[model samples]
Target chain A: MEGDAAGIMDKSINVLIVDDYRTMLRIIRNLLKQLEFENVEEATDGREALAKLRAGNFGLVISDWNMQPMTGLDLLKEVRADPRLKATPFIMVTAESKTENVIAAKQAGVSNYIVKPFNAETLREKIEKVLAHA
Target chain B: MPDGLRGRGASAAAAPPPPPSAEAIEAAVRAVLGSLEGDLTAKEAALLAELEALGRTVRRVKAEIAALGVEDITASHIPSATDELDAVVEHTAAATNEILDCCETLERLEPQLGGEGQAALRGAITRIYEACSFQDITGQRIAKVVAALKAIEARVAAVVGTVARVAPAADAGGAAASPAEAAAGARPPPTEGQALAQGPQLPGAGVSQDEIDRLLASFD
Candidate 1:
């Protein structure tokens, strides 16, 4: 158990990336890995991601703003609604660029918003910014 | 206008008649020539002075005609729209398969990730991220790739959304093929993105044997 934890601690800090696109979530996970963030998770939608968030102690939530049934904003709302996860940093990594959407996300308590098609460095920056402030 | 050639031929036939004889003709000619004589004489002198001008025109026209010599203009052909579509289709299909293959590899490795432990999980994720070209880069680079992928996605989306293109496939045999029923044809597998949404990832070392079994089973 100590060996397991030592290995785990060597690459700690769980990160959950939620996006409908598998390639994109994998990309975000990989980007986090490059930042030495080995503990990463991917959820396809808001509901499933929310379930994982409820179950795990993720340091951050990187999600797409536009999705079916439940969006990143919905997950943000859910995270904010939950008493246990309200303080958890939620950064929306998505393709939404509209002013209203940003404003709405801000209102719903989003830690940050990253317009999609971002690179590993931008992702790293956003992650660092979120974790630093968190 | 086709018959107008006769009028030109007729004028050419009457071209031999000379003026300067009959009083009426001479008077009429002299009257007009009287006013234009000075300019006419100057023109004649200039023509004599520049006799090479006509030669120059003929030479220029000959050069132009030589330059206009005909050859095969269609030798270097621009590819047809269908050819371009075929190329794009081939590329899209290959990229899709590569993406699917990467996902399958990830699934196969999930069990092994357990044997190597969490470190292996990290290693597998690392492999995936690298294979997908998702490491040590800038947002700009990722954006460029994503933009290109999105453009391609848009084209594929358009193809997928096209009722006419799909409809033609059903009618190729001259039989009415309803797309609703014709949908039974095997479509391309879901992209890696779609697979991640629904599949179990990183099952850990507990399923190492199962992972090996699955990998071995896939050989058949």
Candidate 2:
């Protein structure tokens, strides 16, 4: 548990980020790279994210809330419901910091909730908090 | 001759005065209508009621707009107008990030520069890097603006949908496909916890980040 935060910076840990915005995906990828985690994957939306999650063995999942057809909350619910992916650490990143959204994500069994416009340090802290439990 | 002249004069005098002209009649009708302005016709009455309801809706929207921290929906307040603002902000952020990347490259090449040049370059790059950090702060504020716009947009859509639904007589422009309905349909079915999803909050509007963290931590 103590070494979990340090272990997150390990180059081997595969992180998957799901967002509809290309700019956001790039920003998150850069932040993850800055933290020395290079094995990052990207998905455009929840549907794509689910497929990627099934195909890859990822250490952590970071997703945005507002999306078309399938939202991050729905994705989280699906993740929690799946037998193979139920234990995966999932972080929901969104511009919406609404109490309701946070509560919904929590009820869906999200590992962490991050408000957008956040810095890389904040991202690291959130990832560390979730990854520590893993 | 004198009898005929007298007969002609009598006949001319027997002709009565003419009725009012078309322009004078039109003026009179207009005056009557102006007087009856308060007493609308049946169709006009229905339209008036709709207009009054619309006024009320506008007032409610005005209050909502004020709540968004903007007194008026000027050209800048419109959603499309903000698209440019969003693009500019994104561009600025991208530029800032690129500058930071350049600074990183400079840091890597620092060892090759002479001692004095290295120190000078490092100072310049550090300043530039610090300046680039402004993107984070601007990004936060912009996020708030965008959130406020979304709220306004939702309220506006609801108002429009209501207006459209109310006017069944005018088939030409009914609110058949309400933006509000579309927005609602795009989301998941409401759960008890769904009510808690408030979009981006204004500063000091709700619980702090620490409180949210604690709340989530206590979930288990």
Candidate 3:
């Protein structure tokens, strides 16, 4: 299992991170870099994120829940509804820790959820768990 | 006559009076009517005086409301508060990024150091990264405050609108657009999901990570 996780993590998978806050986007990107996932891309809001998701072949998506124009939940629903993007591993990284938010994300077919103020280890764990399933 | 007998005799001797004359009845009725008319006139005068006093009170209240400068609060002070909060978010974000940049630089230099030094550098970098998350949390909290300020500003502007309608001349200067107009123009229609997108919760306010994990597990 460890070997399998390692093999999955070692792959050069394209990752897309969505956040309205530029600093948050940079922070997530840096965290992904720390985990050696260098092929990371970003979009500021869900609409732009959807566009990027359609244009690119990203293996994973880490998104913030609250954003203008379109929210992360809306993006997840759109992704799930799209046949091509339905199977993409999605992880929600948000400040919204409400139970309803978690339930909504799960129902929308999210692979995992990470509450905000989380460290790199938590991010790593979530990514590994999500990709392992993938 | 003896006292009782004489009184009885005197009553018997008195001639029977004719029924009250029509003229006398008319005079008596007129006097009662006059008294009632006088009372009504006094009451009417008192009521008029009371109404005048009430009118004066209402005018005074209107003046007081105008003096409060509700327009300045909504137009100037509330916007300024939001702008300051926005600046706080911006400055913190910039500082956090700078810190992250420094950490990245240090990480890059770690490879050249001895094994112990490299480990120490990695630990410090990780801590810095974690600490820098304060920027995101604080930014979300401040954004929530800004949203609240806007809501308050809207409410104040609505009051101002009502006052302006009640006393149109109160805003004689016409220096700025009516507060109601400004609020209507400035306020964005709330998005559907805004209520659910509550920013960072205060400590002990929202669900914990462990609880979230357990909930997900239940879904499985």
DockQ for every model, please: 0.06, 0.25, 0.44
Which ten residues in a row are the worst by lDDT in model 1 chain B? B70-79
Which has the higher DockQ value, candidate number 2 or candidate number 3? 3
Kindly report which residue pairs in candidate 2 clash with one another.
A98-B198, A99-B196, A100-B196, A100-B197, A101-B196, A101-B197
Query: What is the alpha-carbon RMSD of candidate 1 to the true structure?
Result: 22.5
Reference-based lDDT, residue B15, model 1: 66
Question: Which CAPRI level is candidate 2?
Answer: acceptable
lDDT of 2: 0.68
RMSD of each: 22.5, 18.7, 19.7
**Cα misplacement distance, residue B134 of candidate 2 (Å):** 7.9
| Clash totals in order | 5, 6, 0
Task: Assess each prediction's global lDDT (C-alpha) against the native.
Answer: 0.55, 0.68, 0.80
**Would candidate 1 be rated incorrect, acceptable, medium or high by CAPRI criteria?**
incorrect
The better-scoring model by lDDT among 1 and 2 is: 2
Put down candidate 2 lDDT per residue, B164-209, tens digits, no spaces.
3222321223233345556677976864323443445667665556
- Between candidates 2 and 3, the one scoring higher on lDDT is 3
Question: How accurate locally is residue B165 in candidate 3, as Cα lDDT from 0 to 100?
Answer: 36
lDDT per residue as tens, model 2, A1-134: 53567665445778999977665676677567656788999998888999999888988899987665567887888889989999999998876676767787898899888775565656778888787777
Task: State candidate 1's DockQ.
Answer: 0.06
Looking at model 3 chain B, report the run of 10 residues with the lowest lDDT sum: B16-25
Worst 10 residues of 2 chain B by lDDT: B165-174
Per-model B-chain TM-score: 0.23, 0.42, 0.64
Candidate with top lDDT is 3
